[model samples]
Target chain A: MARIVVDPVTRIEGHLRIEATVEDGVITDAYSAGTMVRGFEKILKGRDPRDAWAFTERACGVCTTVHALASVRTVEDALGISVPRNAELIRNLMFCTQMVQDHVVHFYHLHALDWVDVVSCLSADPKETSRIAKSISPWPKTSPAYFAAVQNRLKTFVESGQLGIFANGYWGHPAYKLPAEVNLLAVAHYLEALEWQKELVKIHAIFGGKNPHPNYLVGGVPCSINTEEVGTINTERLNHVGSLINEAITFVEQVYIPDLLAVAPFYLDWASVGGGLPNYLCYGDLPTKSYAEIDSFKFPRGAILDRNLAEVHEVNGRDAEEIKEYVAHSWYRYERGDEAGLHPWDGETEFDYTGPKPPYEQLDVEGKYSWLKTPRWKDHPMEVGPLSRMLVAYASGHTDVQELVNETLGRLDAPVTALFSTLGRTAARGLETKLVVHWMKEFYDALIANVKAGQTRTFNDEKWDPSTWPATAEGVGMTEAPRGALAHWIRISGGKIDNYQLVVPTTWNGSPRDAKGRRSAFEASLIGTPVANIDQPLEILRTIHSFDPCIACAVHLYDPDGKHVHQVNVC
Target chain B: MTRESGTTIIGIGNLLMGDEGVGVHVIRHLERTAPPPPGTEYLDGGTGGLHLLEPLQARTRTVIIDATADGRPPGTVRRLTPRFSSDYPATLTAHDIGLKDLLDAAYILGDPPDVTLFAVSITLPSKLGTELSDPIAAVVPGMAERVLNELD
Candidate 1:
């Protein structure tokens, strides 16, 4: 057996180290480790519950608004605060915008290079690439001259001997299967997607104060709706949002979806690989009516066990029996034993690093290894993210989700079982983006209708004062981040946070082994994957990036006046 | 692409990590102390990423203020006009997309702004703190002044 390690995986949000044992070109065992630890949860202790969103929102720079959303929801739930319809609609719009933007950026910038060979694009015929682009969709930038210009620009960038972001890619690897023309087509769209993604987040800026770490309130949204006023969600601002929504929908449908379809057929074999765990989980989000109405969620909340799509299990966040986090193979110690599992309300963040120090060769996997604590749904190491969300919605008989999934499956000419692999995970994200852009239109219309009806109340200040509290309370706020199931649990006493825990998406997917010795999604997915070259394990990246791991959100350590943590030297 | 003629002062850092947040602190100081130059806008680009590409492309010049750890003494300030990603210092803060990568992406997409980076030297913080260290905080006014000079 040969051991291969890919430390500091490139193109991911934070630091992640993956070690896999390969036997005869196929991976037999895998280990996922989150190198950096963030102490955001520890920082939230003894702070005002209302102000927690502002601090937790800094947990990640990539998935900016999701943490704020979850934090505000948790506080609101604890305080029993109900926001107005306009506030709900506005929040829905922001959530959908994040989903659309994050998914597109992931497909084009973060995950595309694993499949596309930029070096191969240099050899592609511009006319042939243009023909292929035109045949895929009517995206308007498909002329032969347009492709030639893109090709020349790429040529200049490559010949400049300064690849920069494209510097570390395995460009000529045998694992890359896209034709030269398709590769060129993807490369052209890659640049276009980068330019287009920044525009969609302007919606967040208009509603909240800014894009990254946008302003949030405990009762409702921070921005008020006043069409006649200058400093609010005014008429011109609303019109700009409308146009941006239309532009986003067009780009996703015309460019993103078509590119996804054009590139997927070549790697259909991936549909059987990287289908990690048999169980899937999704805490549904994007409320159609109110958050209290769980049935009204467009995404549909549920879980599937043993890959059985025939039945969907309802998921409740407040139930301690359902969701529990175990740190048996993690760096932290639980007050009860290391093997004991604790729910979020009772979660602890005590540090006890037992792994080898830096400048070390390998981690002792037999002992504690990763910084991420293992999260399980009812003792099952369930997979989360786009694939889980799609599967749950499909099994729940969500008409739009079912129709889209079936149609895409038909196009690929693959069976329904193909929905369990890396290709399915990638395809589900694109399909979810298509669904969300339309939902964004619906949300926009609803907000405008409320404003026209002269009902523009965005905040509910009845319980804004802490004196009206019950002295002690606890609540859990759940939302579907672009990553997967995300929730923040809070316990408030004396109007301050007593204990707070955030089970982010990556924590569920990139966690280490549990006490039962069961592997999570990241490890299980790489079990049977074939690596063409041990030196350049592109296959490992393809499977891991499919989960779109964000380790910064998973492991946190905050010590404002404490001792210095370990040092990491990156080459 | 029609580029507007103006200077955009962008401060890139995380406000939660001690001296790593010096870029944002400098921008806040400049906003409070200095009057606005015509066609000049200040942006708090928290942990810089590709999202800054559009705003950068819209302007004629971009002055980026960020903290860097290049084995220099803390609070040392250096101004550089880096044309390529290779010209950047070894360590910027831990961002989703590094400043160098963002610049490279902007350049490849065309209409990239003329960028001038102000790298403030500091040791990488191991703990999370909202306030900058004393050495880094002492240079905030000077850093703000240096950034204002670039705008002029």
Candidate 2:
């Protein structure tokens, strides 16, 4: 018998623990166990559909927009309505800020430590670091003083902070092979990115409510803008957002991206690990509301499907059926492996954990490998998010999105087929950033024009009559969150929540064995990845963390008290 | 001690760890509400770090509002003027960076606040919730007013 313990898996949000069985120098099985539980969906049981926006943002701080969007879309689905274009733009702007913030924070603060050494910075030549920080041209707030300020901030943060992000960094790791200059440059930008992320969130607060968790409603946003007469974006507030975006893009293009490719060669073996999942799925993205529909809310609804790498289909949310949560090798008890499909609205929360049992496929079921119930798309796996969006947009011939992809692939010197792999998924994040940037600038003008036309109403004040809403309606609402695909299904009997089922992207990726005992996306993504050291598996984390696991989905921990039936002395 | 002089007032507590900073959050609300009863400094002496000890010791009277992990319903508010004997611990290191270190440091410096009053809000500092629970998050205005009336 052997013990497997992996705690605080580097490069993921919050914390994680994935234990696996290693036999004869090869790992046979593993479990993705989240150490925290955020009962947001459980708490959301009886609340009014409109209030979902205010509450669901608690799912995850990093991807609050997706939560807000999912909540809004769910209500929209229930009401059978769409938002206006101006409303969509405002929402898009809110989503853009989160994306930029999430990417910057992840690359610099969270994951950067895995690759860059903070302790190594003490040996750096400040003058050289200063020079590197200012090398980029046409900078917004770059000067000797600004660079010095950045250095000072990092100094205070590292010195005062308890958790050493600098500990076990790339300075001495065999995996860390980036240049000293690149390391120094990244450290400087890391400090700058923290300050930069806060500024970006101001747009969220100004448009929604406050940072971390914003409050935008269904039908549309609760906030609107008017600054066309001044011919400027309320500069005092939104300027920092625009400035941060400009600074971040430059840093990514000049420093970060280049440094990644340079250091990536050192970790080339990652390409093989967690790399062979070909199935992908996305629920499409938020629909852009039109000008004339300012008072009304309308959104795009599409179901996405893909296999191999080329062919993709965009289906309506209605066409998406056969959704089921199976708990075969799971710790929890369920009706059966092949049970009737239930929308999130009608999800059964009778959590009954019969102590781990032997898996029908593998005996590890006795301690059931994980707590996550497998979510299958029509008896198969489906990938979602940036990959899904990219596939769907290309298939639909969204000319601008396609053009952006071609340009990116041309510059990357990689084929469009790269868009389908893990690397492609990561690259597609950047592409979506560009797509949103283009839309952001365009939306600014549209917002201005719409305001000039006296369109202040973003939400429909008159709501659907309770009598009008179907008593036993089952509806699924889907939207592309910052992390990827997010959806919520509702089953209404006489109106109180009968069952609520949510298939977050993280759930799809981190799921355990279903009634059929299938490996989840994250598990499947992990199969091919070469695991060198069982103790320190950075490659495995990088691949999984790339999806940015939203652990708040269905994480549970229980006390170690249970009745003992029998004990056998084998010693 | 503050009754002897009406010259200065101080507000102190942590501002992070969500509700643990309720003291600072509440005092800031005080500053925002009515004018800080003249010569008042609404300082968010976060976690009451060492830097706050000397400054607070120099104040004539100081009001501290903080999240106290006493057994009570979340947001149950209490005001304590230091006593010789009580069930509660004399010092709290509830936060990683706590107020006890700052106040104790102030005592060590031999210049602790003359009339130091602590408004403890009984609440769970951990689990993330947007709204404040029952009494503590609810009693900010009243707490501030009580401090203001004492200062006046």
Candidate 3:
């Protein structure tokens, strides 16, 4: 009875629970529990469409803009309206700003602890560690001080704020492979990265009117740009951000990349570890000066992966829709896959736990002991996230991302195939942030030009009508959250929400026993995690964070604020 | 001695320890509320260990909200400051010495805040869930306001 569990896998955005069953020291079963239940969808019923953007973004502070953009797009799709190009640019910028911070934080605070092994400092020659720390990136405010002072600051942070998370740490263990000096520099830069990430978040607040969840209107941004006054990116600050990006790039190249290469050889075992479901999904916008005949940004639209590698196909929100909510073995109802998933406008929820499951069509779905719904693409569980989107974009040559990736790969010494793994996935996320930031500047310029030209209308005042929504219209909207692909489905009938469903990023990465009662990605990855001790599931946590598991966008099913249940009003 | 020049509400305890950190959570909410008690400072001095001496050693008085491991059903309210030093440290986890040391420092300093301790009893000292078990969470509202009521 080999068992391993990281009760609360720290890092990432929200709350999560992971458990794995092992036989002969190898995990045979894995289950990911999205423990927190926030009733956003049920609460969004009968709400105004104008409010959905505001409310849905609050589901998760880190990816609010991503959520908001998706929500607004869904309504736009519903109404057949196009947001002005400039407005699109500005919204893209805000979302991009968020990505910058998210990537920086994830790389340093979250994943760095896993790779660098914080406790390894005990073995580090303080002189060499200090030399490496002082050389990498200096913290402006605290620089000029000796490396010993920096180390002391790290100690305080570890002891107090972080609590002895590094205590009894297994640094010299067989699993640890990175050089002591590289780890030392990474740890120091990890602290500097924290400061840099926080400043970038303030940029979101400056534009979106506060962070953790900004206030962006549907038509455009709620706040207009005033570069002369408020939009003042002082020369120093501007240069600082660019410099930080460069510094960050250097760190990723000099440290993270080399270290990943060193460690991969030791763990050549984990390359094939994960529930092998090759279906990938992506439905986010990109900025391409050259619009195709169909009017998409730079990238072509379609769901692509190794399965659909050669033949690209266009996919509307409708073609990529089919979800089933099974509460039989879960905390919530048992529903069939083809039953047309319910909407927030008409959904069912009960917190009582009764283990009952109904068999499915293809995969024999049974036993729903989770709050997560089974979301299958063409009736098969599909994986979604940065890796999926990147793979789709690269496999299909998404013009903008492809160009940037090719240019960067030409500079790296490693093979381009390495970009497909954990290191590439993480680095690509940062590159995507750059793509987003560039888009944001263009967005701001357009909005400002329009506003100064006597255009004060950043929002369209929609007198939402609750009675107009189809009594029974089943719809699902998918967007790229910072962690990966996020989706929301709703079915309404008789002027009330009947069923609402969401398949968050974690659900894709850390999925449970699916239709066939087999393992999902998170479970599959755990097979070779080599648990030294079940009490401390560090390896499992490392692999999980690498995927950037986000629980869900919470309970608010509405894309925006006003469309919440108490206020189901659409423009 | 009854009601000094200024009073501050400080919640101390582990947030993961159920109702133990209820005081801090409540204080955070209290701080976010407009028109707080005049000159009343609310601090979520999370187990600051030896760092407690600084905050407690100031102002007129301080209220320490914590889950005392005393033998009582969860949410049992016991009020004590440095006035009951001998029996106090034993009342909470050794991890809580951070709060006690600060209060002790404040008492040692002539400028101690008029202190009121709101000690909530708990069966489990450390666990997940911000919720207090049963009748305690139900009784917490009344139990929480008792200190404010006493001040009034």
TM-score of chain A of each: 0.97, 0.81, 0.77
Q: Rate the local accuracy (lDDT) of all candidates.
A: 0.87, 0.54, 0.52
TM-score sort, best first: 1, 2, 3
Model 2 off-target regions past 4 Å? A1-4, A21-28, A124-163, A167-171, A224-269, A289-307, A335-341, A355-367, A403-412, A415-422, A464-473, A492-498, A556-571, B1-152
Candidate 1 local lDDT, B48-140, one digit each (tens): 476677767778888988887777899999989998888887544454466778889988987556999898888864357678889999999
Residue-wise lDDT of candidate 3 within B9-103, one digit each (tens)? 66665443455556656565555553356766566554433334434544566777766656676666777755524335343322212343334
Q: Compared with the true structure, what per-residue lDDT tens digits does model 3 show for residues A1-571?
A: 6545444465544455566665554556566765444445544567555466665664553566777776665554444345555456556556566665666667765676666766565345557765544453343332324445555655654554333223334455655666665565566566555444544555555556544456666455666434344454333433444444455445444544443433445443344444245566665555533111234553334565455566554555555344433333345553433234443323455454444332111111255545555444445555666666666676676677778777765655445655545555555665665565555555555555555575544444341354645545555555667777666655545544355445566665655555456555555555655555555555666677767776644321111111101111111
- Per-residue alpha-carbon lDDT of model 2 for A525-570, expressed as tens digits? 6554544454455555566666666554445212111111111111
Candidate 2 differs from the real structure by a C-alpha RMSD in angstroms, to one decimal, of 9.2
Best candidate according to lDDT? 1
The local lDDT score (0 to 100) that residue A376 gets in candidate 2 is 68
Deviation from native of the Cα of residue A56 in model 2, angstroms: 1.5
Which residue pairs in model 1 clash with each other? Answer: A37-A556, A37-A557, A38-A555, A38-A556, A38-A557, A39-A556, A39-A557, A39-A558
Indicate which candidate wins on DockQ. 1
Alpha-carbon lDDT of model 3: 0.52
- Which segments of model 1 are wrong by more than 4 Å? A556-571
